[model samples]
Target: MRGRTVVEFHGEIDIATTRQSDQHLDAATARSAPSVLVDLRGVTFIDSAGLGPVCRAWRRAVDRGGDLTLLCTDTRMLTILRLTGVTPAIAVTGS
Candidate 1:
């Protein structure tokens, strides 16, 4: 919404899913000044592999003068992001 490309991720996000997630994220952040929103509310589990794509996407967005936001209401996910030092680099919102 709001002229942004919204990517929603569900279920477990681990090594197995990173490649696909990376592809989508890469596409979402390809254009200059692209605005992307990654919805992670449906995610139940995530690991370092999953976070790698997120961080890369954030970097790509910023490098292209764009921005990427994460939508996650799950406490566990939020905690993981925080502990992993990912929250500081990306904007996260919920509901």
Candidate 2:
């Protein structure tokens, strides 16, 4: 994990926190890491708005020739991401 950076997301995620999350996600992904991990293990609830920042951060990492992976274990959140077709866009793994 020396060349990787992990950005942890905590608690519930909704439209109210998108801006803050996006800002932090952007900053984390913008760092000089070969891979970026958006850790969602601590997140309880997530909606479409929550997915936006994660997707955007993934795109930013990809545009910089880096990989952005998601670290998530919650079954429901994983199901939501899968049903929304976001799982295929970025690598999703467990801690």
Give the candidate number with the greatest TM-score: 1
lDDT (10s digit) by residue, model 2, range 1-95: 45677888899888999999998888877765448888899999999998999889888888877889999888998999999999887889987
Positional deviation of residue 59's Cα in model 1 after best superposition, in angstroms: 0.2
Tens-place lDDT per residue, model 1, 16-84, is 999999999999999989899999988999999989999999999999999999999988899999999
Q: Please give the TM-score that candidate 1 achieves against the real structure.
A: 0.95
Return the clash pairs for model 2, or none. none
Models 1 onward score TM values of 0.95, 0.91
What does the lDDT read for residue 9 in candidate 2? 84
Error of 1 at 15 (Å): 0.6
Q: How far is candidate 2 from the true structure (C-alpha RMSD, Å)?
A: 1.7
Task: Name model 2 segments beyond 4 Å from true.
Answer: 32-34
lDDT of 2 at 81: 92
